[model samples]
Target: MRVVSLHSPAKVSGISTAGARLSRLPPPHEPWTPLLIGRALTDEIVRDTPLHDAPGLALCAWPADMSPVGQVLLVRERLRELGARVVIPNDLYHGFVAAALDHHRGVRVGAWLHAEHHDGDELFERCAPISDAWRCVSERGLARALRVGAGLDIPPAGEICPACVEVPPACAAPSVDGPLRLVYAGRLEKHVKRVMDLALLADELDARGVSFTLWVAGDGPARLDLARAMDTHIRAGRVSLLGPVAQHDMPALLTSADTLVLVSLSEGMPTTVMEAFACGRIACVTAGCGGAVPLIEHSGVGVVVPTGDMRAMAAHLARFAADR
Candidate 1:
């Protein structure tokens, strides 16, 4: 039941969050190990991981000093030594390596995919065929996997696994009120998130004389654009950029708001929708938000509009304002 996940050096930041998620699941008969590429794991990482000092199971990190092919070979050999039954890789190249390990040795290979647009196009075409199965985190991702005819079921990794969830059935009824409390809790990026749509929506709401507060939470390369686009609103006290909320503090931010607004151009199932639904907040999302449309339709947890449709977005905002 031993499983090893391959991760790049840049994957360290999510270590604690991943560890927290893993700790919530039932541990397998054998300990699950996360195989990361690094010279050494920081004390902070070890301290955050639940199984850091587990009796039999421990963390594993290898040095980053080999060619891509050489590293793959090393990882393959190491997995053999550790008696690892399964390998999970995040990207195509690594998935190819996992497939190689499966072909060379008797190892199960699966991919952890989270994006729909990427998964639908190049990613699935390149990686899904090579891997035995996809541990898709979103319904859209799963459909894309099915489109490529990759296996749908996640291998029973026993312990090492990604958290895959379908559209939840129930949602908390929204407070739905005057001066609607709207919030956007994700990257303020122009490319993927289309944060500009939000700014436009704000302008439309403002022009229509809607009394509302739209809090933009999160920071990224497009923060300046967002600030520029909504400067007047920020000064007018209609929008406020919270700037990089820690994951733990998200619940408070979500709960305080009446609805979560996301006008993303493309996405997997965003957790903001789930968080909003759990807090009795409807998620007003874009069609580009992958599986969110289905979730919104089925669960009544949110509303979905087409990507980059400012008029439609404004209409929804107006409707919400009217309802409130």
Candidate 2:
């Protein structure tokens, strides 16, 4: 049998590399294939398209951003074309698979969870109907998968895939300085990311006579508000708003600062924290945010403060900054 896996080829170089690696494997008894489709799946789709040389089952990473519904439709159609079953990387895909199964009954759909998180239950409840099997990356993730399946009112029947930690190559250490080098990166928006706390913390530092240089690395709806809060610093060059740096530049950007801070109210295992850990930098993150609690405790990599507690967060930043 030939297996085919599908995902977007744009904006996810990591996945593309992994897909290319997985695609070269000889067809297993239960074949698998990786297909990069949808918008921007290739640099020049008309000229250079990477095609699978064999046949097999189709696995998916669930690229449902724009035209999410259409992607599901296409997957369903392709399954019919190959007379093969559908496989998914996570419960996020279960929802899409459920929708596809609603339109095309008798199609086999399965799940392969990459991590264990509290959101497992929610995902299964929303998309476990077409799921005929389950898979996970670790024993913990498998336990979560079992719980998720049970919560979906389904019996357990899944496998565990080996887990791989994404560690970065060894790099030079970050520079420590007297003036606290506070940095905040990621989306800049009050309604969604609520990253305004970075600016407020900078203002508090100014008020408390603590010298610091705040680096803001993105632009969003909250930029004006953050700018207004530190108008003087913005003009004096103490606070720099370098809008939208590339992902590859993140290591250099983070290593330049003494402490990496994120005040986001919501997230899902933010890669920022991982990136910080890989960079060997400490982080000041929001407590009970997404699933960072374990990482914070296990790695001794950083601190976790209550969401929107500017005073407490500022205090922690002060200590961390002073230590550096």
Candidate 3:
């Protein structure tokens, strides 16, 4: 069956990366087409082109400036033209559109839970009546979905589809005598990502005299602010911003670091952490990083500190630096 994965346009984000990978699946799996909405057709990134190197997986975008009814109508028309049998909406707006069109147009609607947020809960609740299926990025998300389903008297049928990355051949581990190499690869957003907290962590580490280097990758609206916040560290060569690294280059970037750091205010499951693991690196994440907390605790491969505890994070880094 032809499936359409609907999401917003993001240059370097988990949703965009996952959508691009889904679109590249070889035969035997259902073919997926990624459609980016809520952006203007004239936007430079909205062009109808294959996303990255994914063959036949053209990226499509639609404008969001239209009226709600008009947006729904346009989506319906486009889906009909694309002959989409299954519609997987990754965001709330598109989820509503798919929910509205599911029964009316005989298309199967699947709600995608990529994060643990009120918006995700609201989408599940609103679309449960008509949603044919649901998938979540982490076990926490799946459990939440099940809880919601139980409350609504719906059957628990959500699937856990965690984010993935290709594991390359293991590279030689970095020298233990050198400074601890830490990296953060994700959108540099302040709200959910808590990037400003990362700045504070940098300050804590510097104040503690920890021998470490932090490489921050990716870009977002808060990039300028984060840069300003880390100005001292950046000038001191302790922090480097490698803005918006390409997907293909991620494995090397991850392998170069000894530990991956994520101090997000929230997450469903971070692909960056998975990529770091794939590259044989440990992680040091905050409790607010969602599913990663338990994974790290149980697996004993990483460290987890309470959310916003920059001093604790710095303490751990200092220990790693001194012990290594």
Q: What is candidate 1's lDDT per residue for 1-324, written digit by digit as tens? A: 666665443311233234333433464443345554434667665543433433333344556676667666666666677677766665536535744556656787766665677534566566655566667666666666666654433332222233422233444444556578888977667888788888889988888888889898876678898899899999999899988565556667777778888888877667667666656678888888876788888987667888888778778878877876
TM-score against native, each model: 0.73, 0.64, 0.92
- The runs of at least 3 residues in candidate 1 whose Cα sits more than 4 Å from the true structure, single-residue gaps closed, are 6-20, 27-67, 70-84, 95-99, 102-105, 118-120, 149-178
Cα deviation in Å at residue 90, candidate 3?
A: 1.1
- Per residue, candidate 2 scores C-alpha lDDT tens digits across 147-190 of 66664555465655532223557656765766788688766778
Please list the C-alpha lDDT of all candidates, in the order they appear: 0.65, 0.59, 0.78
TM-score of 2: 0.64
Number of backbone-clashing residue pairs for each candidate, in the order shown:
0, 15, 0
Ranking by TM-score: 3, 1, 2
TM-score of 1: 0.73
Q: Model 3: number of clashes?
A: 0
- Of 2 and 3, the candidate ahead on lDDT is 3
